[model samples]
Every structure is written in structure tokens, then in C-alpha cells.
Target chain A: MKTIKGIKISSGVVSGPIFNFERGKLTVPKHFIREADFDSELERFNTAIRKSKDELTQVRDLVHNHLDEDHAKIIEAQLLAVQDEEMITAVRELMVREKKNVTWAYFEVMDDYEKLLLKTFSQFFKERTADLKDIKKRVIYHLSHEKDIIQPEIIKPSIIVAEKMSPSDLMHIDHKLTLGIITRYGGVDSHAGILARAFRVPYISNINRIQEIVSYSEIILDADNETILLDITDDIKASYESRIQDFRRHRDNIISDKVANSTKDGVPYHIYLNAGFVDEVKAMDPALIQGIGLFRTEFLCIERNSIPDENVQFQAYKAVLEKMNDLPVVFRVYDFGRDKLLAMLDLEILQEDHVFDEWGGIGFLLDNPEILKAQLRAILRASAYGNTRIMLPLVMFVEEVVRTKEILETIKSELKREGLAFAENIELGAMIETSSVLEELDELAKYVDFFSIGTNDLALYLLGSGRMTDLTKNYYHPKMFRAIDKIIKAGNKAGIPVDVCGEMASDPYALIGLTAIGIRFISVSSSALAAISDEVSKIDVQQCGKLVNSILNADSAFTIYSHLKKFYHEQLE
Target chain B: MVRKEIKILNKYGLHTRPATALVTLVSKFKSDVFLEYNGVKVNAKSILGLLVLAVEPGANLIVEANGVDEQEAVDNLDRLAQQKFNLE
Candidate 1:
């Protein structure tokens, strides 16, 4: 087998057929059709278009049945482009205007708009490919864009080598057979990089036109050493043995050491797990997590379909509770406004839409009050096994808290009247995802037993930025601290326990910053639990307290963020 | 054709989804539909035509559809105005 070398982006070893998709262009065939063949060529092109359109639909169906209308337009566009009135009519106009045959006229009209069509189709394919989660999707996407001779070989073990990819492409690649990803273009901050980290696959991006260096179906890879050995032979293998030995050393170095969370003064903080899905709960290390602090119910409502049936919802909730056993597992009810989840639900049911109509309609999460009632009723039913807390997301005002509490009270009284044993005094809380909640903390805290700061959303709202789109925005920035400072002061004043559950909580460097801001409680991912606890345990709370005071007095979020980084590095060094 | 002008209020500019929704709504009527914004007028039923208008949040636009449901067309088009193009 021939071999080629490149940088390893992720670490894994596999050998499979190489599916190299070159970003290419298609245009009108060079030679014009004769008058005799015009009818036949047009028919052929129409057939090709029909076939491609059918393939797109089929491919989409394999991944998902119902697509959002916007996504549906992509397929619609492809269909429309095939017989576009403008393109067809333009060609007809050219035929009469220039005295050219139908095929030649069609070619000339298409040729002028060829670049525009390609650009449109390319973007459309990019989006559709990102949505693809399986091979059927890849094939469909490829077929949609490339109407030429289309074929898909059954390659069980496959390796994808692409110039660059979107997040959806990386998500769809069959992780089981896909050993590694080799990209000629991308960066450490690319979605591909984020995905590689998430999938635990070794991938190397930004290899400088590395595609030309390695041919399709070439044997390559040095997974552990972060190299893609090209043209490998026994001699090359023998020579790389020393490097292979280092892999063992590196693996040993990676072996994580366990540690507990205790302050310098020996005060301990709860490092709970902030899990969303049942699978994530199963993945958590029991020894590391105190319990599930905030289970985002919104994730359960992510896909475009019917609201989860009671059994489905119960199963997911039960799975997390079962794994936690006696550990406290707080189930935060779906609290996001209708924009993300229930965009199609009736507007009247959405609470936020009454105030804002930017979202097409209130999503089911916020719009449907009955959902909260139904979900709380489900949780109350499951409360027998584990310590449970029912929390809400984006708790903005006191009235919402009162409204939810009233519903819960009714559920409790009904359970009592029915003579069923349930956890009567289960804790209630809200995610401080919006800054507005901070203003209403005095009144809101009375209803909530504790608070969890979802810095992701809070920062987005505070910065007036898009939460999903703007990833570069940091919660560790000074403005976030100001918000956190407000939360800490408000929660502390109200005597309500408060914690943070954002990606920022996963950062060890932020542990001291959090504690300094009087955020003694942190809910992190299972993978981050041990490391954060270890870091938090070592921090001098008094020193953190001093930092918090300094940060609070600082002029801006950036200044406070920079100061914290300097302090963290100093401690580490 | 009777014409009425309105504004685009959705945060995200008129893209495929909103365009499709708008076009589909107008197609329900038996009227010739047209839209004008920034001095450009195009067929309301055409996606490319609608997108080319690049109607963004806070942009004023005019709608003209003349047929059997021309008044209903104006009413539905008014809903788009009231809906503010549905971007949050």
C-alpha cells in the first residue's frame, strides 16, 4: 500500500476507502446541439434534472422527514432551477432574438447565469450537506450539486479527505468506520475542530493544500504522533519506532489523576453535573459529580417534530435519575422562548411573543403553559427515587415565577388529594439566563430555592449578540463578571444558593474567578468535573474574594477578564 | 393594480423561508402579485425576485397584487407587515 503524510487533527487509527469530494463546478456542455439532436439533448438534461431532484428528496428523507420550510426551499430551489421560468423563458427569448436553436439558446442563456446558478447551488448544497447525518445525505448532496454520472460505492470503512467542511458534514460522517479526518483547509477554531474535540477523533486541519500531496486510496496515518505518514514502508516504520515509543509516554501523561474540591481554608463547594440528554447522564462519572444541578429540558425539545410523548419524556428523566441514584438531580423545565423550539406553535401560547413578535410565533416551550404543568407533573411522579429540583430557564419576572409556582402548588395538592406519595418539598429554581432576571431577583428569589447562571445566554443578551452564532464572545469577559456580580449580590441578599452552568464553568482558570465573584457553586460537564473540583479546592477563597471585589470595581468586562487571566497564569506558573 | 406600502421588520433579512411563506400566501390569491422596495419591483411569487429585493428589518416596502383576491391579497400582505417578517 502506498502512504502519504500530513498533520493529525485528531487521534485514531483506521483504514478505509477514501471519499475525496472536490469542490467542483459544472457548466453547459461545450459543443452546441444540432437542430436534429436539440430535442434529445433537452430531454436528456430534463431527465438528469428530474433524477437529481428525486435524489435530493430521497437523501433528505433518509436523515429527516419534516424539514423547516426554509430548508424545504433548498430542495424547492433545485426543482425550480431545473425548469426555472426565467432560465427557460430567457432561453426561449434568446432563441427568438438570436435565431439560435433551442439547445444553443438554452446553453447561451444558462451560460450567462451559469456562475450565478453555481454560486447559489453551492451555498444551497453547503447548507444541505451540513444537515446530512448519514451517507445517504452525502450522496444526495453530491448528486444534487453534481448532475453528471452519479455513483455511490458501498465503502464500509471510509476516510473522508476534503478541502474544508461545515459542522453538519463532520457530524454526519459515520464515526464507527470513519477513523480520521484530513482537511486541507480549516483552523483550530473551526466547527470541524470543535467537532473533532467533541468526537474524540484525532484530526489535523490547515495543512496547506495537503490534498495534492496524497492521492485518493493512498495508505497514510500516524495517529498517535500527530503525523500522517505518507508512502509508509517497513524501513519508515522501523525508523519511526522511537516516535512510537513516545506515544506510550504521552498516553501515560494523559492518565487523569482524581482530586476533590476543597477551598484553601477547607470549605467545599458542590461541583454538580449540568447534563441535558439521557446519554450525557449515562456518560457522567458518578465519583466526580455531586449531582445534576441543571438539566436543560430544552434539549429534549430540540428536533422538529411532535412534542415528546410522556413516555419519551419520562424515560429521559428516569434515565438521569436512575444514574444519579440517591444523588440530587434537578430537572429544569424547558424555559426557552418559542424561537428555538416551538417556532411553529401558536403565538398565543408563547409568553414572550406577547411582548416580542420577532420569533415567527411563540415556541412551544414558552408558549405552552400546559407543557410546564405537564412536565412538572411528570417530574413529581418521578420524585420518589432521587432528590429532585424543578428549575425553569430564562426566568425574567416575578409574575412568571408566581404563575409556575401556582401550577406546582396545584399539582402538589392534587397529588395529596389523590393520596399518592410524592416529594412534596422538592426544590424550585430558575436559570439566570437573562439579565432582566437579575433586576427581579428580590421578588424572584422568594419563589426559587436556588439559582443557576446560564452565562451563555446571559452574555448573549447582555452583549446584544446572537447566542448560537457568536461563539467568539466570552462569558469570562468583564461584563459577564458584572452580571455575575449582580447575580451573586442578589442571590446572596435573598439567601438563595446560586451556581453557574455555562461552558465557562468548565474552565479551570475560571474556577478562581467564579469563587472570587462569590459564585461558590459550579455545575460542569462530567469530563470537566474532576479538573474543576481539583482547581477549585486549591484556590484561596479569600484571594478569590479580593479578586472579585477588584473585578466588580473595574471599569469594563474586558479589563476584569484580562486581569483574571493574568492571575490564573500566575497561579499556574 | 391597487398598491400599498409597508415595512420589513424581521431581524434576519428576507431569505428563502420567509420568502417562501410570503410567496405561498400570495399564490393563494387569483391575483398578479408584485412587491417593491428601494425602488425595485418584482414578482411576489418568485423566490429570486423576492430575495433580490433584500428586504431587511425596518425597511419600508410596497405590495401590488391585482386579481380576484386583490383586496384579500392586500389584507394578507398587511399581515406580513403586522408580522414584521417574523425574525427574532
Candidate 2:
């Protein structure tokens, strides 16, 4: 028996046979074309291009129907690349000049372009090299008739092992026939990682030489423990089988537990789920969550070639509201920036020296008033179906709030002119993420109905560390809790309720601090609802307040974290 | 032939979408449009040629168009550059 340690991206345990899927690096076959066969080879190249384009068009339509238009845009870009006049002319010229095979000619042309792009553009544009390579792979596959690694059909339920998987590759994976994912490369913030988490699949990444070590072996993936047990003995296998049964039973018990939203001391706090996709909303248990705190609208824009029209946005928003049975849902405006760029909206990349200065949240919306108006109009229209609210992200300035409110009023008037029905009393809010907003909380609160403190960004901005990075995990900072405390106090002064919808809200240790700060509403991922609710049921609000007060008086974040850990073991555990 | 010097005003400079827009717009005219930046000249109607130039914000380029619609093409392209390729 052997055990390999890896970073656990998503938490779950499963044992199954390994389906080893390797994305073999394409080695272009270099050969001189025979003088007699030159014309036929050139014809073959043209046919291959035509076939690849047809396949891409089919893939684009399929993705559009299955996922959304945004995802379809990725393949659309590839189609355009295939039809790019300059790239095609360059390849043709290379083939004619060197008398080389089609594969080698195509590779050389793409490689030269890629190198040029990498040298000239910033990292943001340099990332497009992957897309270029993706297009290259499609054409090469057509030329060579090589089967794509991620074929739709899988014979059995097995753990998918790969050297690396791209976002597009992850989208095509058959999740039902897959037990878990073990990969040699990927960060927690990768698209594959995010999808795995959203799907509640057991995933582990950065497992060195995992493909070599566990080739088609019966593997036990304990994501909770971050261990991959390989070739286990019969005795161990029996023990794990029972353990799996126990774990499932325990999970079922948690799900079935009829727990109230209030703490043991009778302090009621609201718990909502953060959803970015329709599938997440459909999977949520209404009884477990009170409402949807954050519906990330950016997800709808990421993969599409064009900005989603009002009807498309309206349908998505309305579907979530209908599924949630009229529960209070907060729709955040399209927070496009460095990570989420809309292909249709050709907005400027606003990064100054690697720092995202003004591209996220309200800035992007304000810069493009038309896009913001479309979203506001859609959200306002959807609000007619259920209880709804609008939340703006990355609001660092009071002027931003005022500008957004003005835009909202303009959209409302336009809708009124059109004689459209919308909820009259839809509330508006802003995410308290930066210190600039925190300082002006009282003034900003006057313009909005409530505040949802985004702890992930708040913590990162406060500590000057990036999220999901080693620097963030290693550093202990209590500044975020202090920021939350200040925001809650400001909300109290303004007679508004403040909620938190960041990673901190889902964390057990952070929950203690949050409750202590008098935060009444907490929004976490749906998967974390049962566990967090279970923890909330055990917490005594008064005790949490006192403990947190002492911890706050402590020196640093490290001290507060250690104190909280000790308190958890002594009391909750 | 008509020639005019202009600077890229968009925050992200001439990236993919803007490059495509420029190429598509130039292709509409009967004129042959050529852009010269820092001694490297490329056909303005070719997306790959424009992208390879990798023009950033504040870079100065001379737009030259020659044909029956040379004046109109150069004037329209200069206007597009001034408006930051319509990507405000």
C-alpha cells in the first residue's frame, strides 16, 4: 500500500479505479514534402482546415445549448482563428517556401506568432497563447485524425487522473461517470478547480508524478485528509469501506438535522448561499438556506462572445428566483475586470504595474453605462417575479454608489416609459471590501439599504496579499475581523443590517469572529451550509462575543487565530 | 494618398477586439491602408499584422491610405483612433 500527499481542492472521499487520461504534448512531425505529392498535401491541409472549422462550429453550437453563450464564445474565437486570413496565409507561405509537411508548417507559423505575442504584450494578453495552442490542437487533430483525450463516453465510474486539464477540457468531462479528479498541475483558483467545487466533486491537485504512480490502479481518494491511498490491502479496504459508509451516514444526518437558524443562545443569524450558475440554485435545499446572498452575474458573461442581452439576463435571474420559491435573492452586477473580461464589451484592461487599479465591480459598470443599464434593467425586470435586491461589488468611492444609483434611476424610468412591470421596492447594497469604502460606510449606507462585507477581498486588500495564495494562508491577520467590526458598527449607526459573503463566512473559525461582531447575515457556498449550520447551532452568541473581544484585543492576526483554534477545541469540539 | 499620424488612446491599447475592429473597418474601404509604428509597417486590414505590432496606449502611428477612397479611409481611421476604437 502507498499513500501520496497532495493539496485537497474539494472535500470528499471516494474509491474507484483510476482512468488515466494524459494530454500528451503534441510533437509536430517534421518532414520535407515530396515534389510529386506537394499539390495533394496542400489540398489535404485545406481539407483539414475545413473539417476543423466544421467541427468547431458544431462544438460552439453544442456548448451554447448546453452551457451558455459565454462558454460558446470560446469555441467561436477558435473558429475565427481558424478563418484568420493572416494566419492561414502565413502557414500557406511557410509550406510553399520550405516544402515542409502541413503539421510542421502550421506549428512553425503559430510558434513564431506566439513568441512575438509573448514578447510584446503583457501577461494578460500573453494568456491568449493557450487559446492559440487550443486552436492549433484542433487543426492538428483533424490533420492527424488523433482522438481527443476527453471522449464524452466513459465505460465505468472511475477517478480521472490527468497531468493537467484546461478549463475547456474540464467543461467536457462527464461528471456523472467520474468519481473524483487527481491532477499533477492546477491551482485552487483554476477554472477546473472552481467547477469541481461547484459540482461537489472530490478533487486534488499538484500531486507530483501522480499519472506515473497510479496508472489504472484502484485508488482511494480521501480529499478531506488530502491523501491518495493506492493499492490498499484487503484489511485496509474493508476498513475504508465501513468508514465511507459512516461518513455518508454522518453527512446525511447533518443534512436531515432540523436545526434552527439561531444560535443555542437564541440569537438568530441569517445564512444564505452564494450561487453563480443556475445549476447551483437548482441544487440548493430551500430548507437549509434562507436565501441567495450573492448571484455572481459575471459567470453569465465570461464564456460568451457577446454581452448577454436583457432577455438572456432576465431569464437567468428569474429562473433562480422561481427555483428559490420567492426567497430574497441578491443579484450582483456584472463584476468584469482582470479575471472576467467580456468579449463583446471591448473595455480597456485597467491594470497599472500588475495591480488591478480600476477594472472590477462598479468601475467597469460605470465606465460602460450601456452594459450596466442592460443588467440593471434585467434585474429590475426579474425582481417582479420574487423578492430581490441589487448588490454592487468593489465600491471604493462614494461617487461610485451615487453614479450607480443614478444609472438605476435612469433604467427604472426607461422601464416605466416602456410600461414594464418591476418590483417597486427592490433594495440596493454595496460590498464592503476596501478600506476606502469602510471609512465612508456611514455615508455610503445612506445610499444603500444594506451591506455585504466581502471578506475575501477585504482580507486580501487589508493584508496586501492575494487570495488562494501561500502568502495568504501563511499570514495571520485580524485586520479583516476589525474591518468587519467597524462595518457592523457603522451599519448599526445607520440602522442597516450588514452581512458577510466571503470565504471567511464559510470558515468555522471565522464564523466565531463574525457572530461576535454582531453580523446578522452570512452567505456561504451551498455545499458549506450543512456544516456551517451545524457549527452555528452549537455556538453561543454571548460566549462568542466575549471570546472574540479578548481575541480582538490581542496583538496580531496570528495570535487571534491561535486563540480561536484553542477556543474551538476547548468549547465547540 | 492620404496620411495622418495618431496615437492609441484606449486604456488597453490595440488588443484583440480593437484590432479586429480596425481590420474590419479598413477592409470596407477601397483604399489600401497601412500603419507604421516605430519603423515597422503592416497592412492595417490584416488582424494578424496589427496584432503583431502590439501597439499600446500612447503609441504614435502614421496611418496611410492610397486608392480612390484614400481620404475617406484615413479620415475615418483617424477618428476611430481618437475615440479609443469606440471602447470607452
Candidate 3:
């Protein structure tokens, strides 16, 4: 029994077979099973193949209906591969002869054929390779999950051990069956780590030899102690079992028990969640949040190769709003440009050189008015169900909002003409992220319903252009706080509420600073709620106001940092 | 028994569409059909087997069949080849 210690990301104790998920790649687990398990393993392999066939047929039919017959033929070929008897026999023989698990045997067989088809993984064979690889991953996905896509539970759940899990990989995994996650080289601050933490998965990182540790049959993870126990004895398992119960009970209390959305003195505030994907939207407890402050719409389209049509986008928006009920849900229009580009959209890379050349978020969307129309149409249609607001991303000009309002007016008129019910007075808001927008905050706020400060981008634009700076390290600068302070005052003057819906909203010291500046609505990932609420409960609004008043006007970062440290130690600690 | 030599004339040769077409056509006839090229022979009824051969355009394959309707299968396949495996 070897025990390895690593940094604990989320606290829990879980015991399960470890699945080695390489970053952005699906790797097949090559593990042996008992000979007595051969029949069941083969059964599992057959079931996976059946599921793959069913999935392919549905997709093929969908293509045939919506697209041309040529696209359907590609899926038909995959269906042929699934039904091929020789591949099935080879898989069964390999599993029965070597007593291997179903996924192991199946992956080996398909991989051998894929290698045969394309000797080198090159551009010329990309389509064929992609087709074959799609079939492979589909079967494996079916084997891992007990039911269809987006369902919570999985059959043979495994703890994911990765070198580094990316955000896309985080989306691929179903949280309910993922017992825990341990990466060889990820910090708790990494994007994937934060996501996993938000999803309430037990996670740890910075362990050596991901390859070495993943070879074990099963693992007992004691994240509370940052210890992984392999080859556990009966006595150790017994002790850990009780420990697991205690840990889950403690954790459940933290999740289910609501914290007051106020300061220590009962000053009222609202806590909202920022959700990107369907699972997060579906899993939200409306009682715990005021609404989803920033429904990242681009996140929905980024994962797919094709642009989602009005119906797809409408369904997604409808799910979120229905879940939120009457709470105001802000669905940000597709924030695509610069780093985020759609594959199917006829768009060139929006380079930094084009920062001011009609390539801003609202500019790009206005240029591609079709994408904007589809999103607006969807959000407006969904508005009939619940309280919905449309927020534009990276707005630098009031004219952009004015033009969007014009487009919305046309869409609303069209929807009304078509007999589609929608909220006629749906509010429109703009994200105050761009530096240019900060200067025109009062004017921009006038054209919009409200403002949600995207501090991540605001800081990047504010501190990014300054001397001797890495955009990553320069966050929540005093200059940024001053900028946010300005945005809040302008928003207050304009009689529109301002929101902080960025990483700064969740960070302890930054949250205190934002609260001090009299920002009331804070939106963060659900994982940050407990900690933020705990900090909120520690001090009154008066203390936060004092803390900010003392140093927010200071010229030096050092002075602000020292003051914040002193304030935290004096009050929070 | 019926045997004939045919050349792959489709744009992608014996790739997915042509391969699937070949398998579907051969599987329908009551015959044991086989395609031999470069000393490698595979069951004509299996798409994977036909694709593994990777018979390129203008490549010749000796198609052999032996069953009650062997002649009909070979005749229909020859007609398909003449039309470039119904490339569309």
C-alpha cells in the first residue's frame, strides 16, 4: 500500500477506481479484470456498441432531416463500423482471452484499425480520423455513463486523475459519477480546478507521476489530509468509511444550509450565480441565488463546431429562466470575438491590432447581425417565461447599445407579428469591461438598463497597458478599484444598479473592497458562495466602508496592500 | 463461380461511401463475395474489410463470387463500377 500526498483542492474523502483523463484528450484505461468478469465485460462492450449505434442513427437522421443527405452518409459509415461483426468478435476475443475490461478491449481494437487507416496523424486524413475517433469516444462515453447525455448518474463511476484538466474537459465530465479529481500538475487557482471546486467535486493537484499513480486498481482519497491511500487494508477502509460519512455530513450542511445575504448588521445585499453551461443552470437552487447574473452565452456555442440555431439557443435560455423563476436572469448575448471564435461562422481572427477597428464585442455581433438576431430572438422569446435581461458584452460605445436596441425593436416587432409571446419591456444591459466604456459610463448606463462590471477584462485593459506588467499578475489593482468605484458612482447617478460578476467579486479582499464602494449585487461561481458569505458575515458594511475609505484613494499599490492586510488581520482574522 | 477484374473509378476510390456501397451491394446477393488486390483478399460484405484494402482510384481488384446468384452479384457490381461506384 503506497500513500501519496498532494495539495487538497476541495475537501472530501472518496474511494473509487481512478480514471486517467489526459488534458483535452480521452485516453482508454487499460486494466485487467477477473476471468469470471469476462461475460459481464463483453455484455458491457455489446451494450456500448448498441448505444453508439442508437446515437449514430439519431444523429444521421437529424442530419438527413436538417442537412443534406451527404452529411448523413458520413454518419451512416460510422454506423457500419459499429455494426461490423469482425470488430465485435475481436473485442470479445481480446476481453475473454486476456480478462480485460470492456473499454480496454474495445479501445485497443478500434485504435488498431484507426492506426491502420491513417499511418500518420496528418491534415489530409483529418476528416476520416475525426470520424473514427468520434465513434471511439462515443462508445467510451456510453460505457462510462449509464444513461443518455446530460443525465446525472454514471454506471461505473471513476475518480478522474489527470495531468491537467482543461475547462473543455471539465464540461465533458459528468459531476455526479465523478467521485473525485486529482491532477498531477494543477493549482487550486487553475481554471479547471476552480470549475471542479464549483461543481463540488473532491479535487487535489500537484502530485508527481500521473502515469505511475493511475495504474492502481482503486484509490482511497482523504482530501482533508491531502493523502491518497492505495491498497488499503480492511482496518484502514473501516476508519475511512466513518470519516467519509462525517465529511459528507459536514459538507452537506455547508451546501444545503443557506447563509444570510447580508452583512453582520443585516444590511441587505443579493448574491447571484454565474452559469455557463446547462448542467450548472439545471443544478442551481433558486432559493440560494437572486438570479444568474451572467449567463455566459458564448460558452454554449464555443464547445460545438456549428453555430446553434434559434431553437437550440432558445431552449437553453428557456431552461435557465424557468429554473430561476421570477428572479432576474441576465443572458449575455454571444460574446464571441478576439479569443472566442466560432468554427462555422465566417469570421477571421479578431487580432489585437483590430482593437479599435470595428472589432469590439458589440461591433462584431452587429456586423454579424444574424448571430445577434438568433440570440436576441431566443432570449426575447424566453423572456415570456420568467424575468430575463439581455446584456451585451464588451460594449465601448453608446451607439452600439442604441443599434442593439434598434435590432431588438425589429426583433420584438417580428416576434409580435409572428404571434410569439415575449416580454415587451425586457431590460437591456451592457458589460462595463472595456477601458473606453469606463470613461463613458454615465452615457452608456443611460442607454442600458444596468451594468455588470467584468473586472477580469476591466483589469486586463486597465492594468494591461501599463509599464512592466503581465496581465495575469496585474488584477484588482488600486487603479481598477478606482475605475470600479467610478463605474458604481456613475451607475448610481443614472439610477441603474451595478453588479460585480468577475473573479474579483469572489476574492475575499476584493469583495470587501467592492462592498466598501457600495456595490450591492455580487455574482460569483456557486463554489465561492460559502466562503464569500462567511466573510460577509464577519464584518459590517461600516467596517468595509472604513477599510476602503482609508486606502482606496491611496496612490501606491503597496499602501493599499498594507492597509488591506492590516484590515483583514484586524477585523476578519 | 463468377470472377471479374474491376477498377475503382470514384473520386475517393474505396473510401467510406464507395466502401459502404460495395458492402451493401455484395451483402444483398446470396453469394460469398471477395475482393483481392495486392495479394490481400477480404470479404466483400464487410465495409471495414473493403476500407482496409484502401483500393485507390484506377486500382484493379479481382472480384470473385460463388453462390446461387453469383453472376447477378458480379454483373450488378460491374455496372456500379462502370458508373464510378455511383459517386454522388
The TM-score leader among the candidates is: 2
Question: Residue A247 CA error for candidate 3 (Å)?
Answer: 5.0
After superposition, the stretches of candidate 2 with alpha carbons farther than 4 Å from their true spots are A20-155, A163-169, A189-192, A246-254, A257-259, A303-306, A342-358, A470-476, B1-88
- Give model 1's clash tally: 23
Tens digit per residue, CA lDDT, model 1, A1-573? 444455544554543346664432122223443456545645554554455455445423321323344434544443344444455567556655555644446545544543333444234422322211121222233323334422222246555677765444453345555556777765443435545544445566555655554464544456545456555566766776665455434322321444355676777777777665576677655654578887766556432122455556776777778788778898877644424333312111121222333221112344455566678777887786678888777776777777778788898898789886678789888788776667788788887898888876677678765432433336556777788888888898999998897767876666667788787788865445555766776677766677866776777656767877787777643
| Candidate 2 lDDT tens digits, A1-573 | 888999887778888888776542465667888777668777777887887677667556644643355446555556666767778788888888888987789878888877877887576567556666666766775566442332434579888888766543554456667778899876665556666766667888888977565663687889889899987887888878976666545433425544357887888878887878886787666665688899888766532323567898999999988888888999999766544442222111211114334347787678767678989999999988889999999898989999998888888888999999898888999998887787798889899999998876776678766433433342236677677778988999999889988767777777776787687689877557778888888888877778767655767877877877776777788
Scoring only the A-chain of each prediction against the true A-chain gives TM-scores of: 0.61, 0.76, 0.71
lDDT of 3 by residue, A267-385 (tens): 98877777777767777677766678888887665443235678989998898888887998888887754334411111111111123222447777887787789889999999999
Regions more than 4 Å wrong, model 3? A1-17, A22-113, A118-131, A134-157, A166-168, A184-194, A205-208, A216-247, A250-259, A302-306, A337-364, A463-476, A553-562, B1-88
lDDT of 1 at A528: 52
CA lDDT of A116 in candidate 1? 36
* Model 1 C-alpha lDDT per residue in residues B24-84, reported as the tens digit of each score: 6776788988888778787887654565455665777788978888988988887876785
Regions of candidate 1 where Cα sits further than 4 Å from its true position: A1-259, A302-306, A335-339, A342-364, A413-421, A468-473, A556-558, B1-88
Model 2: interface root-mean-square deviation in Å? 2.6
The true-versus-predicted C-alpha distance at residue A30 of model 2, in Å, is 29
Q: Supply the TM-score for candidate 3.
A: 0.65
